[model samples]
Target: MGYVKLEIRCPKNVAIVTSADPDPVWTLDDLLSELNSLELQHGARISVSSPPKKSKMKEMANGSNKPFVMRITDDDVYESESEDESTDQRLITGTRFAFPDDYFSESDEFDDEMHEKSTPSRLMQKKSIEEGALFELESDHQLMVKEQLRSKLSSLELSQKIESENSSFAMRRLEKQAEARQELDRRLDKQYQRKIAEILDNHLSILQRNHEQRSQIEERRIRDDATLEEAKRKEKALIDEKLRQEKSKAEAEVRLNAIKQAEAQKAAQEAEIRAAKEAAEKQAARITETAVFDASKKDLTEPKGVENTRTSGNIKQGDFVTKQLGIRVIASKAALEAESNRLAIYDEVAGRINVIDQKVIDKHGRQMYKYIKQIGGTVENVRAKAHVLVQLIKDPMLPLSISLLVFANKVVSLCENPSGSFDKSAFACGWVIVLIASQVPDVMDLVLAEFHRSCIYTVPKHLQASDAASQTKDYWKMLGYREEDGKIESTNEFLNRVESCMKLYAALIQTEIVGVKNPYGLNYGWAWLAMFLNALPANRTTAVALEAFLKMAGFSLLRKYKSQFMKVLNVISRRFLPSLKQRGEAVHDIVMKLEQYLDDKIYLREPEGRQLQASSLSKFFE
Candidate 1:
């Protein structure tokens, strides 16, 4: 960070001569030393001054409190011993600063020849040598240069006749230019006068034509007006005669309409009476049928102590008990939460996240799960549909059984579709689940079930299933593996899918949407981390999920828990890493990632692309 660029100038010319080529990056004294060597090489007095005011950053860059002024005069070079210089020789080359030997190097053969020459001869031929630039000009040298310049300036004089001829040529050229301009202006003026006269003539003729047109139009309009008036008078007389006839016809038609209306009203009244009689008869029949049905139902229902003693031969055993139907007084999760005080705050943390099961649904009937899925929430509205999903899942209007079943299905669906961008689907699901868990702690049980069912380590548990207990494919499937007709997913891809799930889960654990201080946030994240490191054994699956979880939520956990959280990290370093290492190349990449995450302390910064529930909620609200 402590790097600087140098600007060098020559006082004689009062312009920047060269600049730092590589850019100086060292203490101020070292930069000043480089300047000294540069000055000695050029035999110029170099006075260095910094900016008028030093910046705070600049003050921090160096330890030196001394004034920012360092000068290396020509006298300083003569006084300093040669042994003080460093071994490396850097030179200012071209218009740039601080080039190496190759840049400023002269022809090798020429340098050798110069070395062979006597010092006096070298000084005599110094004007041609490149090294002449290295020597500052003394008083004698300045005088010699001025005299040479003056001698070169002295040359032959021009003849008086030649000078006079030149002056005459200049005067004649000026006269010619003036005569041409005057002729061009006269031509332009003549053209302008002709155009003006032409325009005026055209205007006068157009006005005369327009006046004649107006007169003709006026005469025609007057004749048309006289004709129109005569036609209007004739049409008016005819209209009066026709109106008289139409008035007589209308009086007769009105009498006929009135007679027809009276007859129609009589017919409508007769039809209404008939319809009323039919409706009354139908109503009487319906009442009679209902009376008969109620009498039959009373006879059947009120049979005194009558029971079906004879058993049906085709009926299966325990059919009567199994198929019995009655209203179920099923207790809901909200009722249980109230009883258990699952959401009650104790100490500093709230116990909002819980494990949901089929207890409530079992009371209602397991088929409610199927029913809930069928009539489940709609995903029609694509805008923040996840928030709506949370509401639907926890809707009390929906049967508890149906909500739990639908929620479980939704959670399990994410396991397969974790193949896509996590933020859109999988991570968004995590946000929904967190909110539901916070407000409705009963849902946490369902979330845990689905997560643990897919990846056990998400529950912070590792299982080593026996080969005899299940086939290889079945075991992998338990860990959320995908299978086609026969082929199973590759381990790396499986880890990728599982890692996305882990990211979502981990993110949800620590995600705090500002308004709703997540009860299951950093506090839960810390506990999850500590519990996972303490309980889980190291393996490729564990390694992937652990590393992914840390990457997702570690920043928030570290910030929240601080030193206590770091102790858990130390445990990971001391305990978890060795087990991963013993797995050889199977988990080599994961091990490396874990090691890097710890070494670099990547948890110091928030994971990218992970939207906390608070941010997501704000977006939804917007």
Candidate 2:
């Protein structure tokens, strides 16, 4: 038999069996059995076609029938072959097998030949060949199916992998965006914080500056208030002092007027008594003359008879009477003349005292007129006027001196008006008054007292202490001290002038004027010395001059006014020491030397007694 090919279809796989022999035949049952075996081996259900119909088999033998083909049906039987087998043949023939003509032939002879060749050995070989072909076909089909499945699965896996990658990339991009937003927010927050901090710092600095400015303003206000209060106090004090001085002056003037009035009354009474005495003497003389005349007439008429005796007696008596009467008349005349002369002398003396008083009044009026006229006068004019007044005070004529003193007193009174307007002219006038006092020793007490009163009420010039050193040097130079030599050029002359001034002040202090306290409230001598020292430079040379003056004046003052001298020492310690200490070592050393001298002269004599005094003085240095 030629090779035969049979195709069987299953649900999952298609199988084809081929035989090498022509006219190969097998029973339908046997074909079913082989198919079942393939199904079991391949793990699938297979089906075979039934044998062809007799007529159909004859037609196929005649080459007029279709090829045998089969497909598994739901009933486990193959589908019948169709007449249009060209497409099915191409599908089966891809396994490289050809269909036999007698494979589906129904001839009895073909059946017998198949039966004869279908012995066990031949069947076994055929079965083996069929199984091998089927296996080869099945394996080829499986490989093709596997290749298609692998390609489909690979495509699906590639698509899934791409989707997964896209999802992961999207998630990563979102995460990065979130991180970027967070970083941006953090940076913005930091910038906002920095701005806030800067604002706060600027506000704090502004507040600090404002606070400092306010504090400074407050301090300045406090200082201004303090200054105003001090000025008010000083003004009040000056007012009170001025009133007191005016009252004192008024009282002194009243007392002086009272004394003058009493002296005038006494002089008037004395003059009246002299007039009455002179009249009584004149009347007595007249009565005595009349009596003598009557006695002479009676004696002449009495008688011629006893004329001899009477005449002799009467003549003698008349002669005696006449002599007595004449003597009495002469005595009365001489007494009357003496009384007239005495009254004339009294009148002249009273006239001279009146004239002196009038002269003083006139001088005062003139001086007052000059002062009023020179109210705004130049310093030179004031100085000249003061010089004239000084000369007038030095005049040997008592009346001129008294008049100048009265004028001086008036000048002092004018200077003492603290409430009055102060001008340069007024200061110049005051200087003049001080100079007049310095020149006139006799009026030193009155002048110095007036000077003190004026100074007490008057405000000092506004001199800065900063210029004190230069001013002091200039003062020394003016006093004829040589700056290069650091000494007084005319020591003796300087000493003499200083001594004279000290003596004048000393005499003022010593004069015991009743009810008149020293206007400076200290020993006039010491007050003058302090005043001089205050005006001069607090330097060694000034101190030396002060020392000389003190040595000259201090002992006398101490002996006469011990308590006052003690007060002077206190003032010196309190006032001079502090200023001297500020000046330099030269001034300070001079002061120390003076203090040492005082200690040696005064305190050492009775250390126990003067302990408090020494302790008080020592406090200045401490």
Candidate 3:
């Protein structure tokens, strides 16, 4: 007897069947019963195929039986195969069986049974089989079904294990790849951070170096500035010391000269007195001798009583005449001595002034203006020279120099012909006058008078004609009054030049004495103020020319020397009121403006107000 191997296929699993004994061949009934039992256990239907009859069979006597093999395929594939002998032979040799068409229809029931079998109670119930008559009959059937179920379960377990293992391997592979990517990203990020830090450090170092360099430069600049300031301070101290020494030496010399002059004057006075006495004695002797001769002759011829009366009358008349002659002689001698002393003082003062003038010329030379132009016309150098000139002028011990007068004359000349050029020398001269007036105010009158004579009233003779055309033509030909076009300048042009000089002089006076304590009283600028007022109505432009001069002078007087304000105001008001009335609105406006300025600046009490009220100019304000 030969044994057979049978394979049964289902949707989820394949079942293999083999007979336990070789002598018992599996019949159709046995096969059907086994299939039915398998369907019940696994909850799926299965199909079986019959083997073909052979022509001859020889049973070999062997200790082990040879088994026939059978295989199962899908029913859909089996139905598609063509029916032929080769196919039948292949099917028989292959021992394959096809599942029924209802295999999938039973799959749901099969899953239910599998779920039921997984429960522990159902598995225990299935394991406990009872031994009885029915049990004996179904024992073989149950045994076959159990074998087929075991094969199906084993096949399912094998496939599930293979799938689980493959899934675990793929999951592990993906995890490794993710870890590698993370490590690479972390390394790259660290490298980038390090690079950025290096770059930042390099930039910080550069900035620090630049900051240090700038600080050093600033420190050097500060040091240089301090050095320069220290140098300037030392230089200024030296200059001030030198000026003080010079002033002291000059004062000493002046005092000594004054003492000598006084001594000489006293000696001269005594000599004059002695000569007058001797002359009177000689005249008296002559008179006495003549009288004696006459009386001797008269004594021989005339009576004693008559001669005595005649001698007494003659003596009385001669005594009266001699007394008058002696008095006249004394008066003449004193006058001569005074004149001689005056002449000597004048000569000495003139000589001292000439020496100062020579010093000035040597210090500045004719190229002073050239030097002024060289430094871009900045007045710093000019101002320094002006300060020196002012110091010279303010030297009280120095005589009123003719050189000052000469320089002033030259300045006035330049001012009158400015020709649209800045005259630094003229400015310096004006400052000199201001210093002189402030220090030794007695010179103010003289300077003002001279300025009025030489510059203000000294118009060109040709320009003085009554005929306007002739005046204009001659004005063009004059050296100091000509215009750029070779034609006569307008009145305004001429006035402009005069006004500029006046303004310069006014500025000098105003600026130089701003904080000075004027011991000379506020009468300092009175001459200039009076002169300007007197000339106010000389011509149309004269008012304009004097306008700045008047304002500055008035303000200076009102502010600096308020004590003399009323006196100055009275004098100006008296001189200006008549002219203000005649000159119409222009002059009136100018006067009114000045008046308003004064009124605004000055606060007066009843007495002062009353003084102002009494003035004729006060009426215009009213």
In candidate 2 the C-alpha lDDT for residue 285 amounts to 22
RMSD of 2: 31.9
lDDT of 3 by residue, 262-355 (tens): 6686576556645644543323222110122111112112121111101111221112111221111111222233334433433444455555
Pairs in steric clash, model 1 = 355-445, 356-445, 513-614
Which regions of candidate 2 fall more than 4 Å away from where they truly are?
A: 1-126, 152-168, 197-220, 233-622
Global lDDT scores for all candidate models? 0.50, 0.44, 0.43
Taking all chains together, the TM-score of candidate 1 against the true structure is 0.36
Compare the candidates by lDDT and give the number of the best one: 1
Using TM-score, give the best candidate's number: 1
Deviating ranges (above 4 Å) for candidate 1:
1-387, 394-398, 423-427, 465-474, 517-519, 610-622
TM-score of 3: 0.34
RMSD of each: 44.8, 31.9, 22.8
lDDT of 3: 0.43
By TM-score, the better pick of 2 and 3 is 3
TM-score for each model: 0.36, 0.21, 0.34
lDDT digits (tens) for residues 173-228 of candidate 2: 99999999999999999999999999999999999999999999999999999999
